[model samples]
Target: MATWQCVKQCGACCHLDPAYRPDLDEYLSPEEMELYLSMVGEGGWCVNFDRTTRECRIYPYRPRFCRVEAEVFEDMYGICPEELNDFAIECCQEQIEGVYGDRSLEMLRFNQAVGYIYKEG
Candidate 1:
């Protein structure tokens, strides 16, 4: 499958959703952790993303997880800033299902899932 064309100069993904790693506190080495903590703001968006430039300050040494390739039919929810909330929920549910299977007791509510992790942090 061909990869999707990501919008260049768009910071949609940064605002789309946050990724949670139980090992976020463990996997990252000291320097990596410090860099991430310094770059990520309250909800994990790049701290230095200039809305005008739509760029990250630490793009070169961005976390390994941040280097995502756009996959075919990958279900983009962050193409437009306005749809970020809904897109985040869809992405989260997809991830939850992928990990815990389709039988998770956590009832999937699209709206409720949007920014859900933000509250936990």
Candidate 2:
């Protein structure tokens, strides 16, 4: 089975465009919503994301909404621990595909890291 793992230098999740996530209020609390919006910078990328480095500047202290922990996923999306792997993988797949093309290098790296095998259709 495939496991979910974040790929290095793949900051696709940092593309925090509110336009694509219209249901932000549904999942995040009021404070989180505000913080989430505040993090959105030019081109909808996270303000803390260093484009050149492809890394989060505030990674160590990033908001709860930015974490991929089981508890955080449970609270935000009602995802149980046993389901976290697939759920996180799916979320990453969609986000990465949206931020970058499905065939982009980021997607390739993410799939390999997660042990996800796919074929072009």
Cα lDDT listed for each candidate: 0.48, 0.92
Candidate 1 per-residue lDDT over residues 1-121, each given as its tens digit: 1112333454544542226544555445677567666666745556766656767666776566455433311332124644443444555455555443544543233223332432333
Give, for candidate 2, the lowest lDDT window spanning 10 residues.
111-120
Clashing pairs in 2: none
Pairs of colliding residues, candidate 1: none
**TM-score for every candidate vs. truth?**
0.38, 0.96
Error of 1 at 25 (Å): 3.5
Q: Estimate, for each residue in 3-106, the C-alpha lDDT of model 2 and write its tens digit.
A: 99888788988999999999999999999999999999999999999999999999999999999999999999999999999999999999999988888988
User: Model 2 residue 24 lDDT?
Assistant: 93
TM-score of 2: 0.96
